[model samples]
Target: MLTIWSGLAVGAIYVLVAIGFNIMFVASDTFNFAQPQYLMLGTFVSYTIVVSLGLPLVVALVVGGVVGFAVGVLEDWIAIRPLSGTGVHGELVTTVGWSVIMQGCVLLLWGSAPHRVPGAGSDSVLTLLGGRLSVNDVVLIALAVGLSFGTHYWFTHSKLGIAGLAASEDRQAAMIRGINVNRLSTGACAVAGALLGSLGAVVGPKTFAVFTLGSILVLKAFVALAVGGFGSFKGALIGGFAVGVVEALVGRYLGTEFANLAVFGVLIGVLLLRPQGLFGQRRERVV
Candidate 1:
């Protein structure tokens, strides 16, 4: 029972990261390898606001999100925009270079040590279904689930969200139809950054503000994305929880070392069996 709760808590973080991936992919059809840097920036920004300045948690989160949003826009402008339509696959390298650069900047600003950020909620533990969980855990889970579903609803119902989707599906067609693809792409990055920032604030208590947090979380989130089927929002939710639960159980029963093995084992198996992933469709190319 404790294991399940723990898995859910961690899984919530993965879900948030995966959603960030989904947003950028949907908008630009380009994976931002530097996406996880937003999470790292958020954690550090929140720590500066809430701990160094002694501000309220809400204010810290807002500031962190704004900073992240700005960085996202900057990323789109500097790293993504000029490379657009170049068909040179330079984005792959550029995004990775940007990620490395962010890491270096963070190390210089925050140092290599991890900093603790206090949780917003009560410290008391709650017993649910015979499982021990804290208020922070509950809040994290709720926020993650709410954001995931809320995003799905937004994409389904909102005009701008729908337009974003249309733009992703066919950028040329969307442009012909008077949709501003560039604006949508930038908006998508901003939204993703905001989400990651707020998520970093919420999960800081558990993971602490560390320069390396982004790398670890992003790797697992990518596993979730691959397992769930890229571009499928619902799949991200399911895959994240699934990876978390399976990892927890494996670690508990087998060993910590085996946990990663099992996770990657599942990934390899899935790829071999269904190359498109669980919810992904195989795209056919004409020769």
Candidate 2:
């Protein structure tokens, strides 16, 4: 039970990284492999503000979000926008390069040591439904679940969100209908970046403010995205929680060495059984 609880908490982080990937991928067909790096940057920025510079946690949160937004915008301008209509799929390689650059910058600036942030609340364990977990875990679970579902509703219901949906469905058609696909793409990146940045304060304590945090998250989040469906927020939520719980169970029963292998196995199984993912839709275009 405790293992399940622990997995849920860790899975929430994956949920966040998954959401970042989905949001950007929604507007830009290019997946920002660097999205997790932005999350890693957020934790370190939060740590620097709170620990090194001795600022308020709130300040760290705000600054991290702003920095993330700037980084996203920069990535779009330098790496994505120029190659937009070239039909070159170069963004794929560029985004991966950007991630390497981000990781390198973090190493140069912060070194490789893992730094702990003060938890948002007391870390004391609480028993609920026969599971011992911390208050922070409960908060994280609520946040991840609520955000994923709420984003789904927003995409289905809200005007701007619907516009984003239109853009995602058919960028050229959306442009014909007066939707600004470029702005939409930039907005997607910025919003995704902001989410990654602001959550750093919350996530840092659990994952630690570490250089390799992005590496830790990127692959698992991609797995969660694939498991849930590439573009579905609801799938992101379900897949993330499933991955976390499964990883925890495997780690406990089999051994830590088998945990990653188990996750990869799950990915393979899902791809074989449902290539479109759990919530993914199959599309056919009329020529």
Q: Candidate 1, which segments miss by more than 4 Å at Cα?
A: 284-287
lDDT of each: 0.84, 0.87
Best by lDDT: 2
Return the TM-score for each candidate structure.
0.95, 0.96
* lDDT, residue 162, model 2: 87
lDDT of 1 by residue, 120-235 (tens): 77477999999999898898888778877888788878999889888877778899999998998889888898778766777888788899888888788999889988877887
Clash-forming residue pairs, model 1: none
lDDT of 1 at 212: 88
- The digit string of per-residue lDDT tens for model 2 on 137-194 reads 8878888998898888877888888888888777788889998878888888888888
